[model samples]
Target: MHNISKNNEKPEYGWFVKDLIVAFSIIGFIGIIFVSLGIFLTDLLQLFFIFAGIFIIVLFLWPGLGMAVMNIILDWKDDDITDSFDEMKRLEIPIILDIGCGTGRTAMKIVKALENGGHLYGIDIYNKMAISGNDLERVRKNAQLEGVAEKTTFQYGTATEIPFEDESFDIVNVSSVLHEIHDREDQKKAIKEIYRVLKPSGTVYIGEWNSRSAQLIGYMGIFCFVFKPSKYWEYLLKESNLTLMNVEEKGGFVLFTAQK
Candidate 1:
């Protein structure tokens, strides 16, 4: 694992605490709506509000269920997300950059894979999501706990305008982040930015949620399904100068590889 920065800072778990607060606020708001209108209606709206509050509580209490369902609908794999890259075993030491690397799940894998050592940089635009939902700080703490503290750097930034220099990285990986962007132009800009920061012939790995029927409905599904089929891996090559390498389609994800 490339500890891209030298700060040796502990991973932060403060984001989860914020999630708790937001969850409570959602429940409270729903309660107020229900109480203010329950007596005027046939109880349909009241029941709906009550159910919404219950679901929010469930999300707070058992976030794993929500997160798992998210993975399933988004076709995001909890295990083996980067298993295809195992073949890179014999290559020279490669600098790996992970975009929107939530909680550092795949980042940890890259750390263990590169013994000769390289750089690991993670960027996320939403600090609350990165802190609470992803616990990226905790991931930094784990790296430190495991003595790889010298190899990782985490930053707060956006994908469309990565703060790194051009042609700096040997490999760049993005997992389960495209859909959340919700803008075709921005998504394209981000992809181009990834290519810009990569060295010539450098590899770019992208794993994203495939279109699943269940994902087309529900709130969580709506969240992940915002990015359509075209703006993803398939048309990226057509829109840019990168060379397509391979694509792996799993139940809910499409893992795409390309070279710049």
Candidate 2:
């Protein structure tokens, strides 16, 4: 492995830190007001204010805490990728495409999994707010650090308009990326693009969060609104003319395996 000094390693803040900070700040402001009111009100009113404040804090804090536990402590993303890869049929010298491969996290993992002389192409919009250090240079550097530089290629690209020729790749992996495309029409366009670039009978793995799942409700609370139900993705795949082969749901996260 390519070794780097400890100080050179930058932390990745995936997608939700800003939202979490804003939410907690707003809740803290409201909590202060509630506490002030309790200081001046009658005993019964003060008790009600205290309980209300606690309830509000707990409710809002739950999502952030849950996310931290899942992403940090449990390493949910890594586990999810591993599980998905285990289910995939092995390919010899496969040409793989990884969409929205921020900082080479998923791309590096996939490249490393290839024992044959396979190559993985990773593309992303590199939105700064989506992932800390989410830039082409950062991903390139990560691929080098992970010792997969020769096996991987990183570039600036979008899902709707993938910068590649038709039938160029043998397999495609898209993890937690579709929801970032806010417009439903654009999401459909992206799926079509994936279909256009895939070789005949090529496989595609799409991972997404199910907004309606109870686990998602507990983890994301109101933030679950950011995701779509599993049915939405199934519809998109079918409409794009991809054959949906399997749907795996684990802890509110769904992985759809389809074929071109």
Candidate 3:
């Protein structure tokens, strides 16, 4: 799956770092055995698994390191959020929806982006994700920590079918989650749902990977093979009855804002 969150993490069989650690452990152990048996000396393929093991180990132990590396590769900027919020101020008590809110990070960021008080709804398929803190209780606790729980509502749901009424929100933010849905049709449905839920003149901000070096893209591809992160426009095609507002590229990610 693509795992689009506002910017980043995954469930059982999903993004649990422990899974990577286990895979690395097994690969490393087997790699050592193969190397000692002279298999790697003749067959270089064994070396690939060994290095991959090391990379996974690094990723498991220090998640921040991975984000740091991505920043270097993508040229991350912090101002896109500021701009998004500035635009949101035009509405009164805007109802903001955050789709794919892994561990509530993107949801919290959206809460902070609001200059004035606004009701925020966060949705996620967190049942199987493996981020450091991803349980429903943890999300609730995080919202408490952020002091936005009263105004925020976290729900277990998928982007394909948002659980809300039509024209219920003034702003909808799908950060980094669209790419996680491997099926192109599902991605389009998610966008359609967002469009359906948005009121006329409402705004949407989709933050997802757009441009990146071949090496980096290949690297991420190994971890998330089903991801179709770049073909984002498929979800916001011109014929979708939505108006494209602004498109900005920030490093490896692109933020596309639109109006409905």
Candidate 4:
């Protein structure tokens, strides 16, 4: 574990994993080339289908490629990748946990969203294979930059083994973090841990790639598809100790909410 601090360079709160984005982008580019070749080689009707396939492939692999247009048409009513805490605001929750909080991107946002005072705890493993900008020092600096350092605390922890006591938080969030665990049983174990740490009636929220769209038909979907994510999470949430509240999918990602 390490302490967070401000630095000379600007702090980056990136949402996309840089390595995955690059790998998928290169594959998407190659796919486009092949599809373009087939466009000219096939009938006009076939050409239309080829173009459609290419478009979806690009959107799936390239993060935020044409997201501006998507933003204009789709109403993502929730704040940037957050809805659980937004709900908590209505209840004036005092203690919150952002499990797998990478670089305080969502953690800082959670702090700002609080009109009522709430202390936010963020935990993550800040090692070499951690997400793009996942560093304890960086998260600390980011919290400082966002002016929420006092409202938030950064710590070292893993999803399968959270460092908090039972029923420790009123609200808990685990976003785009579980699928990173390759083992299916371990993923379920992590969800169980989420349930273990929530107070009775406390809310637990999770967001992840569901691979339900055209992304599933392309190379970019390979990573998330391997996990059978939607099915496992659905089964676990319904069968676990929590009451499933709401579930929705958008922009190739899914959000799930439950109450303990």
Ranking of candidates on lDDT, top first: 2, 4, 1, 3
lDDT over C-alpha atoms for residue 213 of model 1 = 31
How do all models score by TM-score? 0.67, 0.84, 0.71, 0.72
Sort order, TM-score high to low: 2, 4, 3, 1
Cα error, candidate 1, residue 260 (Å): 0.7
Alpha carbon RMSD to native, model 1: 6.4
What residue runs in model 3 are displaced by over 4 Å at the alpha carbon?
1-18, 21-83, 218-225, 229-236
All candidates: CA RMSD in angstroms? 6.4, 3.3, 7.5, 6.4
Q: Which residue pairs come into collision in candidate 4?
A: none
TM-score of 2: 0.84
lDDT per residue (tens digit) for residues 1-260 in model 4: 12244555555665344555556566667657767776777688567657765775665544423332333333333346654445688766569999888877667767787887989999987644445666888898877767788899998999899999999989998887887787878878988898899988889888776665654333243443543556668887887878988887766667788888
Query: How do the residues 117-138 of candidate 2 rate in per-residue lDDT, one tens digit apiece?
Result: 7899999998776665578888
lDDT of 1 by residue, 71-152 (tens): 4443333365656875344456777788987667677777677767677888777545434555555666766755666788
Task: For model 4, state the Cα shift of residue 62 in Å.
Answer: 7.6
Candidate whose lDDT is highest? 2
**In candidate 1, residue 27 scores what lDDT?**
53
Name the top TM-score candidate: 2
Query: lDDT of each structure?
Result: 0.65, 0.79, 0.65, 0.71
Residue ranges of candidate 4 with Cα displaced over 4 Å: 1-10, 23-79, 83-86, 127-130, 215-229
